[model samples]
Target: MFHHILVPTDGSPLSGMAIEKSVALAKSLGARITFLTAVEPFHIWTDNANQLAYTREEYERISKESAGGYLDSAVAAAEAAGVAVGRVQVETDEPYRAIIDAAVERGCDLVAMASHGRRGVAALVIGSETQKVLTHSAIPVLVYR
Candidate 1:
């Protein structure tokens, strides 16, 4: 019986699945949904050479546009499903933290998100944000793989 559901997405195929699932769940439960997207801030010192390709201003602009696109798709899905929806965007490298914080700030009772289900060395190397959110969040988490 979640009154408010927080749906965090990255615009990936798996995240799209979670968005669809959460929209259906929200519609059934009569819960309002809040879609959250976290955009990484521009970092001057990064190992990735691609990051250095853009200036700080340019990188921030590009990141915001990309994040906005992701949030827009999620919003469109919820709207199409006739579900009440809101959206939040934060500039932070720690997406997991942003997800948890947004849920609390927005008074969301549950977090519905996607997981790649990576395990072993791959998971450790990639460092799953879903795993981090699961570990850190106090609210209920519905993970869609």
Candidate 2:
């Protein structure tokens, strides 16, 4: 019964699977989907020790390129499934925050995303974005592993 579904992708194979699943679900429900890619800004090393420079142009270009690559596949899949689709690329270091915000901001009914399926030490050291989204998001999150 989801009218609008929000799908977040990191361009991983697991994410691709989730995208396909979301597209299929949307098609079956006659719902639209908003494909989202949260890009982390690039850090630049500066020669001067005092301050770091923020490369806004580079960040925009790189982020868009990354988003394009991810969104293209999602968009194509959704279109092929005969589902309406929207795409968004947000620049945020905290991907989970961005994902939750987009879902709420866009009035999406469901958030479907992929879990990297990390375990033990690796998961603890590098916290899962999917887990963070689950922890902080107010809406429902459907996770695919």
Model 1 lDDT per residue over 19-129, tens place: 999999999999999998777666689754445777778767776777688889999999998999999988776778888999999999999998852221111101388
Using all chains and alpha carbons, the TM-scores for the candidates as numbered come to: 0.88, 0.81
Candidate 2 has an lDDT of: 0.76
**Model 2 per-residue lDDT tens digits across residues 30-96:** 9999998876555465342211332557545655676678888899999998999999887766778
Stretches of candidate 1 above 4 Å error? 117-127
In terms of lDDT, model 1 sits at: 0.79
The alpha-carbon root-mean-square deviation between model 2 and the true structure, to one decimal in Å, is 6.0
Model 2 spans with C-alpha error above 4 angstroms: 45-60, 117-127
Instruction: Please give the lDDT score at residue 122 for candidate 2.
Output: 10
